[model samples]
Target: MSQLKYKRILLKLSGEALAGEGGYGIDPERVHELAQKIKRVRHLDVQVAVVIGAGNIWRGQIGMRHGMDRATADYMGMLATVINALALQDALEQIGCDTRVQTAIEMKAVAEPYIRRRAIRHLEKGRIVILAAGTGNPYFTTDTAAALRAMEIDAEVLIKATKVDAVYDLDPKVNPNARRYEHLTYLDALNMRVGVMDSTALSLCMDNDLPIVVVDLWGESSIERVVLGDDIGTLISS
Candidate 1:
C-alpha cells in the first residue's frame, strides 16, 4: 500500500467488455477474468470502485433511433447495467473478494441503494463496490456517472479501462497510423473530442482536477500497473 500511488480508484468498463467474443450478453469466462484482475488490484490493499456501461445488453441510442421514447430507452439501459453489476459482483465473490452492488435506482431485492457514506464505508472495509444504474437519471451516460462517483467517493484517480492501449488522435481501427498520446491535458482532451469519453464527463473531471487514465484492460496486469504508477496508458490531467 505504501508503494501505491492511488489509494482508491474508480474503474470504468464498457458493457461490451463483458460480452466476450460474441459481442453480446454476459460471458461468464470473461467476467471471471475481469474479476481476477480486480482481485489482484485489491490484493495490493487498494480500494476499488467500478462503473460499467450497458452497451451490450441494451443500447438506448439504438432504441431511440427506432422511435422508442428516449427516457424509456435510457431507463431500460440503466436496468441493464444492474444486470451487469450483479454478474460482476458474483464473479468477484467467487474469487473470494467481498463486493457490494449499489444501484442509483432503488431495487432493494437486487442491490443496495446508492448512498455516498455507505459506499465509502464499504471501500474502507476492503469491499469492492460496483455502482450501477447511471446516476439514477435519464440523459446521462455511464461515463458521466463514473466521473460523478469518482468525485463523490474522493477517488485518487479515474481509470477508463478499454480495449485500446491508449488515447489516439484518430481511431486506430480506422487508421493504423494514428498517433497515440501518452499524456494529455484536460482541455486538450476536451478540444479533441476523444470518442472514448464524453464531454460532460471530461468537464466534470476537469473541474474537479481528477486524473483520468485510459488503458487496455486485458494487458498483463495493466490495471494494477496503473494504480501502481507505471505510466501504462494515456493519462489526462490538468
Candidate 2:
C-alpha cells in the first residue's frame, strides 16, 4: 500500500516555472518536464489541483504601478493564468495523464467553468484538475486562490512550489548566512511578514488550519516526497 501523508493537495505553481531559466512566456520543454513530475505524483493516486500564477507573462501590480486601472490590470493577469493553465493541460495530457482545465472566468469554449462540486467529482474520478484565472475576480493573487480552493475542496494541505527550496529568515541566495525554518506556524509567518505566501493567503490558511508545505519544484522528486511524507522543505501550519 502507498503511504501518503496528504491524499488530496492543492499545488500553487508560479507562471515563472513555465518560463524556465529564460524568464518569460511559456517554454514548452520546461512545461513538459513539469508535467512529468506531476505525473509521478498522480500515479501515486494523489488527488491534485493546481493553481498557476501569471508573473511570467504579466503582473497586475506592475501594470497598476505604471497607471493602468487596477481592475483592468488584474483581469489581464487572470487571463494570463488561463493561458498558462491551458499550456499545462496540454503538456499533462500529452504525457497520458487524464486531466481537466477549469477556469474561474468561464471560458466554456476552452475549459469548463469552475464549479465546486464538479471539480471535486473530477478528483474523485482520478482526473487532475488545473484551476485557472485566479478567483474569477480582480485584486486577488493566485496564492489566495490556492488557499481558497484547497479549503473548498478539503485538500489536506497546500503546497507552495517555488524556485527556492524553503522559507528562510533571509534571502538564502543573497545572504549565505540566512537560516531556514524547518517548521513554522502560519501565525509565525504572518507575524514576521515572512513571504511564504502573500499576507491575505497566509491568513486564510491559518484561520482554516490548513497546513502548507513550501518546497522547490526544481528539486528531484520534490512533489512526490511531499505526498509520501518525506521532509524536504519548510513546513508551516496552524
Candidate 3:
C-alpha cells in the first residue's frame, strides 16, 4: 500500500539465518518462516530475487584450514548453497509461492542453470528467483555472488540481511558506545572495513552505484520497512 521506493530488490541472506538455534544445517522451521517473509514481500507487488550464503552447511575457509584443497572446499560450499536453495524453494511452493532455484554451477537434474534473461523473465512473471552457488568459482564469497546477480537482474537495491540492525563503527556487542551510522558512502564502508560485507562484493556494488541496505534479517517489519523507504537501516550508496 505504501509507495514503494524500490520495485525490484535482491535479498542477500546468510545461511546461518536459517540455521535456527543449533547454528548449523538448515532448520525447517526457520526456512518456513523465511519463506513466509518473502511471500509477504511478493504480496506487495515487488519483484524479489534472493542470493543465499552456505555458512550454515559449510564454510570454505574452515575446510581449507582443516587441510582440504581450496577449490574443493569452495565447491563443497557452493553445493551447500544449492541444498539451502532447494529447501527454500520447497517451502515457498508449499505455501503457494512460486519460485525457481537457479545455480551458477550447472545441475540440470535439480535446477536450471543460471541464465540472465530467463531469471529476469521469471521475476517479471511474479516468481521469486533464488540464486544459489557462489559464482561457480573459488576464492569468492556468496556476498560477491549476490552483488553480481543483483546487477545482472537490474535490481533497484540490494538488501543485505544481517544479524545486526545496522552498520556500527565498532561491534555494538563489544562497545556500548559504538556509533551507528544511518547512512554511509561506499568509500566509507570500504575504508572502515566494517566486516559487514567483504571488499570484493562492496567494490562491485560501488562500481555500479548499486544501493545497499543492511538490515536485521529477523527484525519485525525490517525488510518491508526498507522496501517502503523507511530508512530503518544503514544505507550504503554513492
Candidate 4:
C-alpha cells in the first residue's frame, strides 16, 4: 500500500452531497456509501475531521433574501448542520468507525459543544470528529467553518468535496468552454474570483498556508485517492 500524503485532514462535505441524486433530505444509501469511503481512509490510519454544510436543509443567505432576519436564518442553518452531522455520525459508527459530533453551539443531549482540546483528543484517540454549526454565529458560511475547524484541529489539508471535479473558469455545466485549473495559488484564485470557496475561507486558508484540494465526491474513490496523494483535482496553496 502507498503511504498516505496527509496524516490529519479536514473534509468539507456539502449537505446536498448527503442527499445523493434525490436532491433533498438525508439518503440512507448515500450516507452509508460515504461512510464506507471514510472507513477506507481510516484503514489507512489517517485522522479525519469532517465539516458539513447545511444548504440542503436551509441556507441562511437564502432565508434572509426571503425576509428572515440574518441571525435567525443563520441559526436555523446551524441546526440543519447539526442534523446532518448526527446522521453522518450514525452512519460512520454503523461501519465500525468511532465517531464524534461536536457543535459550535451547545447541544448537550445530542453532541459535545465545540472544545478545541477535546476535539484534538478525539483525533488523537483515532475517532472521526464531525464539526457542525457555522462558527456558532451568523453571516458565515460552512465553507468558513471548514477552514476554522481545519485550523483548530491542526490538519494538514482541507479537502473540499463538491459536485464538480475541479475549479473552472466558468460554470462547466453552463459553459462548455469553461477552463478547469489543475492547480492554483491562493492569490490566483482570489484575483480570479474563482468560486471554489468563499473569499473569507480562501483568505483564511491562504493566511494559514493550508493547502486545499477540491474534488468530486460522486467520483469513485476520489477521497481515498486524494488522501493517498494521487493527482485527482485542483490543489490550491500558497
The candidate that wins on lDDT is: 1
- Expressed as tens digits, the lDDT of each residue in 1-238 for candidate 1 is 5489999999999999899776799999999999999999999999999999998899998999999999999999999999999999999999999999999999999999999999999999999999999999999999999999999999999999999999999899999999999999999999999988999999999999999999999999999999889978999999
Task: State model 3's lDDT.
Answer: 0.94
- Order of models, best lDDT first: 1, 3, 2, 4
User: TM-score of every model?
Assistant: 0.98, 0.98, 0.98, 0.97
RMSD of each: 0.9, 0.9, 0.7, 1.1
Off by over 4 Å in 1: none
After superposition, the stretches of candidate 3 with alpha carbons farther than 4 Å from their true spots are none
- By lDDT, the better pick of 2 and 3 is 3
What is the total number of backbone clashes in candidate 3?
0
lDDT of 4 by residue, 90-136 (tens): 99999899999999999899999999999999999999999999799
Q: Per-residue lDDT of 1-238 in model 3, one digit per residue for the tens?
A: 8899999999999999889786898889999999999999999999999999988899888978889999999999999999999999999999999999999999999999999999999999999999998799998999999999999999999999999999999999999999999999999999999788999999999999999999999999899999999979899999
lDDT of each: 0.96, 0.93, 0.94, 0.92
The model with the greater lDDT, 3 or 4, is: 3
